[model samples]
Target: MSRTQRVDRTAVRTRLDRVTDPELDRSITELEYIDEIEIEGESVAVSFTLPTAWCSPAFAWMMMTDARDAILEIPEITDVAVDLRDHMHAAEINEGVNERLSFDAVFDDADGDIEAVREELDEKARAARQYRAVSALLDGGATPEQIVGLVRKDLTIDSEGRTTVRLDETLSICIESEPIERYLEKATATGVANGTDAGLFVTPEGETISPSEFETVHRRGRLAATNMSGQGHVCANLAEARIGSASASD
Candidate 1:
């Protein structure tokens, strides 16, 4: 047996960084999730692990597919195999990879309309925003009974200094209380407590809340929990030191 030739594995690894984990929203390379990469002649084999075993199977499979596609694009790569280790549904993921690779052959007569696909995606985005608003309300102090009360009809509240919930066709639920900045602070804090990605940040347009704002709110929530909550307040003091160090950079 003869070894075909050794390829520059570093260059191939750099290309793999282009693949991203959709849920974590980070490049696989940054996450240090790639376990090993073996390049022999025209064949490439890669193994990786997910952050958790219970991560969304569809997302993990799609990411693996994308990663394989990216790697195969490297010159002289004729075959590729991506192994998902320690992730739930590894067998299903392997099946999906094979299916995706053979998709063209399986759907020889199928054709996609890019414009129609775009329109469908745009509609889904609107629906997703509405769903997020509903989920947030449900997850918050609001009860399931309260959610049932405000399902269809537009809901609004005018709480005197208390958090009020309002719903609009466009923005879905809008909680109005105090200034926007203060509300953002509270909301972001709530997000952090829930271990959610929600944050608070000012938008470039000076209107409409952005995802960054929710992240900030979540981080603050974590800080407040560590500081204000009894027994856990000690953690908040430690967090304060970290926050102070971070802010000092600014």
Candidate 2:
């Protein structure tokens, strides 16, 4: 019998939290897409489901690969196996991810490049994140100039336990941690600098969206957010139905 390294369930879940649906820009965990997780010896097994069997193979493949990569970060995990439960291309994706094949190698002559698709979605996510962060500041009475000037080190929990982010020592706005978490994750993925003084409202190219263009950027950001929200709701409903069907069958 192989001796297994002690596995922490919390740690495993924490790692998986980093994996997000490419289009939705939401955590697989938050999206309720991670169906199950099992561990044996140094091997980790994760079974996940998508919104539907017909979800885009490229996006589904990314989620699976991201999960496997995230789990492998644990020193105790020497192997990771991703099972795509009900996807149309589940078999192809599972095999491709396990074998570490490129998207083109997995789907030869496919219409789109996976990297390009990923970048497109990443830009949308960054726009959504920046809009949400800046909007929260606006709601809390921050001027447009102040919102644009905000930096990463501005995020902190205040004495009253509310999440607050600041543009300077005396200019802080109260907000929740969810949007901040969302922004930071996508910011890093989009090549934005992550540091205390790094600007919060940056374009996909890692350049700060100028205050003069704030209105246009905010409008575009809101649109991006609305599109993702609609997609997320559809996926959530489909996932619920799938889960219900599985339970009835069981």
> By TM-score, who's the top model here?
2
Residues 151-237, candidate 2, lDDT per residue (tens digit)?
A: 777778555546776657666667766666667778888766477677777754557778897788788889889999999989888
Residue runs of model 2 more than 4 Å from their true location after superposition: 1-5, 151-178, 194-198, 203-207, 240-250
Q: What is the TM-score of each candidate against the true structure?
A: 0.42, 0.83
Candidate-wise lDDT, in order: 0.52, 0.82
Give the best candidate by lDDT. Answer: 2
Per-residue alpha-carbon lDDT of candidate 1 for residues 153-175, written as tens digits (9 for 90 to 100): 23333455434453324344454
Candidate 2: give the clashing pairs.
none
- Give the TM-score (vs. native) of candidate 1: 0.42
The number of clashing residue pairs in model 1 is 16
lDDT of 2 at 67: 93
Task: Determine the C-alpha RMSD for candidate 2 after optimal superposition of all C-alphas.
Answer: 3.5
